[model samples]
Target: MKTLSIDIETYSPIDLTRSGVYKYTESPDFQLLLFGYAVDEAEVHVVDLASGRKIPEDVLSALTNPLITKWAFNANFERICLSRYLREHYPDYFTSYGEDVATAKYLDPLGWKCTMVLSASLGLPLSLKAVGQALQLEEQKMEEGTRLIRKFSVPGLQGRVLPKDSPEDWELFKSYNRRDVEVEMEIRKALEPFFVSPNLWDEYRRDQDINDRGILVDRNFVESAMAMGKRAQEEITGRLQQLTGLANPRSPVQMKKWLFSKDHITHTLCKKERAHFIAHTSGDIHEALVLYSQAQKSSLAKYGAMADSACSDGRARGMFQFYGAARSGRWAGRRIQLQNLPRNSMEDLDLARKMVKDWDYEKLSFFYDEVTDVLSQLIRTAFIPRKGYKFIVSDFSAIEARVLSYMAGERWRMEVFAKDGDIYAASASAMFHVPVVKHGIHGDLRQKGKIAELALGYGGGEGALKAMGALDMGLTEEELKPLVTSWRATNPHIVDFWWKIDRAVKEAIENHRIMRVGTLTIFMQKGILFIELPSGRRLSYVGAAMKMGEKGYKTITYMGVGATKKWERIESYGPKFVENIVQAVSRDILCHGMKNLQDRYICGHVHDELIIECPEDTPVYEITETMAQMPDWMPGLVMRADGYETEYYRKE
Candidate 1:
């Protein structure tokens, strides 16, 4: 097959970060400035479209000719942007590409390839420069690329201002564009040794399709919600000011100093500090902190973002990034973060949403405890179904717990999942060795079980319990160690699995050997630590080696982007690896479910849930049943999905 490797410089007046590529390209002012391409292994070419050069007839024809493949890093941007450019410049070729089934406005995605997706699947960095450096490709991306992008690709001002330099700068920008194509071609070549599976590529297409078929946003609800939030915040700020006499109680430093001045209380107000306050504070101080919390919640940018993210079609798309969490293969949420949505617990959700939508601030203030919190809970409700359809929100029950138990050969836990049992209550019973039930015998002990299950799954101790909020749950300091001991004793097999796998991983790294624990194959090869999961996908740790840290213990180290999202050396241990395995497998299971229902209209998904668009009376149980079927590699792992239909997505 012929390949047209591409890299382009474009200008969009719209904020592409907030409104994704599809919406970004829809802008009237959007322009493809430079088009750089290479045919197969041929020399690269640059077409300065901004300076009024036309794309070659053959290159434009290749786009609509399905046999001529198109490749780019983050190909969604290139593909969608090209679709727009083609529609404007070469309608004949654009029309011939055929309409997309989901969003008929776009060209076909059949031959599009994303090198970023390829890098992510292999656990390489997502950035073009980073991937090139990691793979040590001889043809590196130009360092001047960033500066050139700011000069040329930035919105509004690029066409107006000629920089301090001249035609030479434009030439440099063109060279940068050409170099990007060269780097991208080299990357594709480097990755060809372990090219991503066709199935994974298909999954990438599905992701792009979903992003194109964005979920509907209730504009009325969103607009009213934003207004109500502002009003509520103003009221709260006024109250807080009257009570505290602080000039800016919303400022953390000001609030801390004010609290100290009030009662000589000086302490760190970080997570641990705030957790202590929630557990131990009282009187006026507690009221002040709670008010501050509400004000903080009110100021969440998501409410405003919902309005911005909604396209002209009244739908918000591109909230998901496929292969975003490189380790777990999970789709990370972007802009309005569905994966991290606040769980709605309002008893009368419809009433609360209606009040906010109606902009009845007084009704919300009187009926609800905190109007800002109400706005926070109502965020998910903003994502509504399209005009004629309803959303069927369904999710796997205790998927990670079930996967962990099944992987560890825990029969009792499997039985619980097989019967659709409440794992929290069952876990509490197992830990307490009592009839710990949900609102039944020793019901109070369920919290202990819940916290333990959350914290202690991967060889955690009392510190983990504290981190998981045992203290906030009102457990005594003395009871923490005992609780950890009891939970470990109860789930002896799980604990054993953690340490057994730990030993095997360390040995595999240290001796440069293969270690098989359960169906997982752990080995070190060519400076990369590979864990071949039962699903046949491998978790990669590039430039991996064991290093003894300042903590005086040797641990596994690898090259990765840290919390700050910069390339650096990352450290890990046995429990963390176990976490990666469980999450990756859980993510794979969700992917499998999504793929199984390919014909179904899956509009959006939270971590473990899939929100499908269907008719009001559609049989949702079949969706759940289909999702529960385990793949061939995942035998004896029982899974269950629960679902409910709604006009919009919710916690149900």
Candidate 2:
């Protein structure tokens, strides 16, 4: 199939960084300056539309071609910008794919390839310049790009902003846009060998399709939530001013100085963690000061105002991102960040939601300390029941724990799961050697169990415990280490399982052979490898390889290693590989459950939880039982899934 790789220079009145693509392009002040393209990597072409050059007939035809692949770094930018361009230039074609087309039928997200995602897959930096250099492309585009964006971008004056229209500037804009496509093409070529595998490309395609079928949102919930957020925001502002004896106290830098220099909270009030904690706890004075400062940078006071610009129609659309967390293949959120929002604080969510909708700020503020907490919980409330249906939320119970044990062949751990799978409490009891009663009976034990399970799993030690806020949980430093040790010793089979999988993966990568642990197969190819699950999905390693480290033993590392490009490094098979295995197995379990729930229920999922919108009469217990069963091949590894049917998506 023929592909047209294109790039464009555009101007928008909205601040691109904070406002993002939606608001940036949505502005009435948005306009295209130059369009650049290459057809089959032939002679690269530039059309200086600003300088009055007509788009070539072929280029115009390619834009309309259903089969012609359009490529860009953030293809969303190109797709959206070009979409706007097409609708303005050729309305019939644009509207055909827009309001008229049945989204599931003609929406081929495959028509575009986001080189940003491709770069991410190869562990290349996000910027086109960085990606080009990483691929060792002959030409560099960085410095040229910086100057060109400034040269062609609409100039800003005090009261007016206008695009550059000089013929010379137009030529430069064309050149810059051309280089973007050039750099992108070069990166694609360099990574061609890696993408040669059909599975990888197929996965990439499916990811795009998933992005295309972005989730439908509840717009009314969004509006009501925003209204409540605004009212509380104003009250918080007034209270902060009263307490701090300063106007507009939300400034971080100013708040830091005030807290430390005046209030004498801490010397290091400038630090984020310290400042945030102190700011929240300092009551009216500290919060007021912080609120003033925050308003200066960008008003949290204008809480819900941003939502309308961020949201899509009555439904907040395009929330799910395919492979957004590429490392874990976890979906990321675009607008609301549904993945990381705070759990609902109110026990009776429906009542709290009603209060929020009615703009009852005084009641909510009375119960909740900061408006952010209330706002955070209310984000989930945005996901509501469609007219006649209620959301039946089901999730794999102790899924990560179950997957780890099953993959590791830890018979002892599996047996525990088989017999009532409350691994957190079970882990706590096992660690303390005391019988753990159910939640209400064993109150204090629950906290210990929850912390230990959350932190110590996947071979986490002291540092993990600290990350899980063990100290903040009123556990002393001495108790933390011993608790970790006790948990590790109690789950000895799980510890051994980690080592077992590590050895299997290291052997597979080093020997260029396959290693089997139970039903899982670890395969290596040219230092790039993945585990082939019994269900047949191969977990691709980010940077799969083996090398002799400081430990003097050959260690293996997987691909997509780090959270960011800076701190992420290939590390030892001992811990890093354990993390990989645990996550991979967890992903497989989700895939397994997803396959089962595909057509029988609404195929909606969030992290480990699946929200199946069902009728009131539906038997929830049977739903849990069905998810508990495993695939035929994963024998003797007893698993279970349990969750409540909530009117709104929330944790029970």
Candidate 3:
């Protein structure tokens, strides 16, 4: 297959982090500053069209070729920049647009391969500099060009392009741009051996396609949500001032002192206090540290940075990141953290929204003690329905848990999913060896069982249970260990699956052989371990090595223990990595389902849920059921999609 590496510098007045590509590149001021490219990995060339030089026919052809794949790091920018070029330069290509047309041909985000994705798939550190350092790629040796990059990226920042530009300035810009393309090509070559599945690439392309053709946005709902959020912000800031005698609630130093010294809260969420809290908490401080602990879960800046995502079209775009968490290949939230949003267990979200919006503080506080969940639901508010249309939401039922059961060959768990039994309650019953009657049927057994099944089964012990907020779910300290043990006893197959995978992976690493476990095929070579799925997609680990376990059994370990780039050290042979892979693979399955829905009904997807905006007369249930059906390739995996049609896109 022919491939062309490309890099372009473009300028836009629109804030990219908020309006996203579609809106950003569409700005009237938007103009490509420079274009750099390489064909078949040759000498990088610069094309300064701003110099009024006639563009070469071959370069033009390479730019528009549907089959000649384009390569760039952060390929989203490339796709959008090229798309702007195509639309402005050629209009006739739109006359007969097909369903599978590259999104850049239609809009933006469709026709490129992101080296960032390849880097993530290999679990390499993000950023071109980091990738270059990790792979030791030579072309990425340029020194501190941040200021140079910004000079070209920002229009009129360095100087307004003259009607006839200076040749020397243009040359520098193109060289810088060309270096990016060359670096991207080199990085992709370095990572080629990792071999991400073509199927996965196809799915990724489809994801970009979905993003290019963004869903219909509801201006009114978004406006209302922001208005209500503003009101809440005022109330919270006012309360904080009254409580702490501080003017700025957003001030970290002020809030930190207030929380620890003035309010007698003792606990803090910053990393500096991590060791202190860990030492003093006596290892069983869930209730005492819930607020501070939750704060630590994400960057404190994210709390205030949420406001920066607002867009001019009255629609907040890029709310959901497509494969943002490349290490696991999970979709992280960009403007809003949609994946980690609070689940709506409460029935009436409308009432909750109204309560928060109308300043009904007493009622809102009574229903949900804190505004975290309320604020989380506000993230969903960023997505709104079209004027005449509404959201037909359909989501897989207990998907990851069900996939765990199916993949583990757990008959009991499979049966629960197959029969429409409450998997959590059933898991509780299985663990506790009780009938698992309704919530009222047992004495605290219900909570214990529920928390145990959800938490401990995934190689989680008391700590994991606590991390999942089991204590906050209202399980007592005395019951934690017992619940953990009972969960291990109940889901024997899943527990076995963990060990089975560990053994298979360890053996593969030690022997340099390919081993199969159920639907997962383990491929080991050198220090890399790959778990290939039935869909031809693979989850890979780099530089995996074996270490001795407690009973002399082999345990797998890898470099880069934590999320930070500099934190490269071996940790534990834990379930965190495995869980990440399974979830990513599961998301792949859901993406396949979305592809299926594309043939009939699918407006877009928000996280794991699909929003199908169809005619009121359409059979929404059939759409939901069809989405729930698993591919023939994955027979053991049971699937179910649950949804409701709403006039507005709000949780039912």
Candidate 4:
């Protein structure tokens, strides 16, 4: 067979939603219930494995054959599940390829194609049901599948009804399984014209390899942190109860009522509001508010996630989702979200971690006033390097800023980068006509320059400045408008770039003509707007059109997953498109770096940073230098990487 489109139904005692497919399949009770397949758009077939039906020899061989391509929606799940199924059922077929069933990784991703990834590439929904509806497919996935899955697949649901117990539902479940394969095949055919490029497939393979490799987790550290967090929560709750006399001080409504009745503080208990009130209040009120804020830190729950998702080997797999960010095609954190882990700013993280791991709660409390906050900060330390190996954590320095400068042709900014000068200082020097330094002459202006650089690079205004915490940084409301104007005036080229992109998008949609702005190529094709990046990957905007916006001006709009995550027509502008393009390009540059370092043992990556497990002797500078190399497409772009070696993961 040249190609196989497959789907399967599985039953596992493990919680698949809490634990990823790798950990889910590790359960001894995991069973493959139904296997559906179609060979090259031929007749579809279903083997009721749970009903004791056996798959044909030819079909089984095709699964392990590298020459035959495999297609599925969310192919990673199918590939990983089938890998285990084969090892348990037909070991010879799995081992015939010289792979050890006991230690082999999932089936080679090279031979697999994911329809979900294809849909995501076109800015389509990632779910099979959503994609089927989004595409208006004739063979949509069966809605009855969910109820059937709950009845049969899940454990502890009324003694786990079997096929014999519910014959009709079992037959319907088989049909549901068959229909999924049919829908996946239809999706493949519909998306054939916009097939994922070979280079992207290579990148997908790399992502799969990283996920399969997994990251070592310190189980003892995670468990100890969880226990300490529980104790901290109890202590804080008790203190709040004793001071406020509230039955449930943790409840925001109760706390708000208590604050108003006792201290006459009439405001929401948000982080900023709490900080504001804390500064104005005194005595027991201030102490209670501080305790409440410390108790509100929920990041310590990540330790629980790590503990749940870790495999028997003590490694957490499937933490990163490839192409999870539909707009920018960036990887998204899955089970234990490493992307938003609380930053570790403690001076002695090693000592604190050791104390916690040793379960010395008293000592920890003595050193740290807020034990819950400390536990939140220690979440990153839960990911440790393997024995005899150290972590080389490297990431690009100001990747988005550098990319924005290169794309906008901001010469002064680029010059600052080339000379290794501080952009924030250079921006202050350019905007205010003063030589700004980090902690030297005119250093106070550096904060303004820093805020402006962050908020105004994408055509932000006074509102963006406020959202970036300009006021919290001690900038007045009156200064906000002037800062926005000064930043825009100083970087005329970047402002022009925004408008150029805006006009290009409008022209592409209104006139149905191709438009070029800088290194980007925009065009409309079959109701889709495509912006081809310098890396040759096109960002697709579905159902491109122009509409009269709320501001009484014609705005470019397209069908996409909007703020509510529903498929709808959303409005856009020049600066917003610039943000998307800049972020997308930045993601490509990161992928390029990962490609360069593919030979190394890359355990995980979060945004611009890569965590590599290597020998203690590995030179940190070499990894950083290699990651700093620029791609040929962006020749004049200046790039830099900063990294450090650590025994455990942490932010530098």
In terms of TM-score, the best-performing candidate is 4
lDDT of 1 by residue, 67-175 (tens): 7789999888888888888888787888422243447667677778888988888888889999999888999999998787777666435364343345888888888
Task: Report the candidate with higher lDDT, 1 versus 3.
Answer: 1
Which residue pairs show collisions in model 3?
none
What TM-score would every model get versus the actual structure?
0.94, 0.78, 0.83, 0.98
Model 3 lDDT per residue over 435-490, tens place: 77665565456667667767765698989888887766767788788877878887
Worst 10 residues of 2 by lDDT: 98-107
lDDT of 1: 0.83
Superposed Cα deviation of residue 507, candidate 4 (Å): 0.7
Q: To one decimal, what is the Cα RMSD in angstroms of model 2 from the true structure?
A: 5.2
As a TM-score, model 1 comes out at 0.94
Question: What TM-score should be assigned to candidate 2?
Answer: 0.78
Candidate 3 ranges with C-alpha deviation above 4 Å: 90-111, 155-170, 224-228, 235-244, 247-265, 269-316, 342-379, 547-555, 565-567, 570-574, 600-603
Candidate 1 lDDT score at position 525: 74
Per-residue error at 590 for model 3, in Å?
0.6
**Model 2 C-alpha lDDT per residue in residues 174-256, reported as the tens digit of each score:** 67777777887887777676633233445554444333433345555566666666665676667666766556556555565
Better of 3 and 4 by lDDT: 4
RMSD of 3: 5.5
- Residue 335's lDDT in candidate 1: 82
